[model samples]
Target: MRLLPRLLIILFVIFAPLPAFAVNPDEMLSDPALEARARTLSAELRCMVCQNQSIDDSNADLAKDLRLLVRERITDGDSDDEVLNYIVSRYGEFVLLKPRFSVRTLLLWGAPVLLILAGGIALIVFARKRAGKPTGSKLTEDEKARLAELLEK
Candidate 1:
């Protein structure tokens, strides 16, 4: 029916994922290889303005500038590492979408595992203490004598 088709269309319009690449046509490199590399690098770099989003996914002005800088570096024949180092030098390690593991980041990478292990150990200790405890109190000598006398009577 016509109504069914219109409802389906409306649902599709509401639910369909639209393309959301933030790169403008002018920002793209002419060379296919360089453009691909630039895109890859852009995806790794964090947008300063939109701290949670990668430069590739962010529509921020700073993201645009970072994209341009990546393209410029790739065109200048800098290796991937060189380009990353250059950016890190300028913006600090926080500019990377994924922070590189190093001695400085050891605590950040290890804290969760350490915490989970500590929690498991604590839980085991608590369970042991609970299991070892007697649920009912032992009867005193007077209570035992009273119980025996009551039974005889």
Candidate 2:
């Protein structure tokens, strides 16, 4: 009984998903509402130094700077859209964790679907070609005659 409990605890410790925040205490805003908004915005911004991580979860100096900038913008009474626009202007659209759906990003959004469709079409064509081919080998007349004669012998 004790072994099972210990195993469960070890598995939980190894596999549990925990939120890993990298924001320092000093960077947080005093106002709760402002802090919440800043946090939401931070989660949407990419860490330039750590391209795969959001600023809220990154420990890079650039991520820290971006987090501060977001808080500063929120404190100045900038709405969420305004803050996002301001950051985009400064850092380019690449700063956004999810790119906005627009003409410029259409290719990025459509490429996966296009690739899957192409794969499906190619698979269907390959299956048809395989199905159309004869399954058994065709024997020559001489070979068939030799087989009949051998069977008689």
CA lDDT scores, all candidates in order: 0.93, 0.95
Q: Candidate 2, which segments miss by more than 4 Å at Cα? A: 1-17, 142-153
TM-scores of the models, in the order given? 0.81, 0.81
Tens digit per residue, CA lDDT, model 2, 3-73: 99999999999878877899999999999989999999999999999999999999999999999999999
Error of 2 at 29 (Å): 0.7
Candidate 1's error at 81, in angstroms?
Answer: 1.0
Q: Per-residue CA lDDT of candidate 1, range 104-142, in tens?
A: 889988999999999999999999999988899899999
For model 1, the superposed segments whose C-alpha errors exceed 4 Å read 1-15, 136-153
Model 1 lDDT-worst window of ten:
12-21
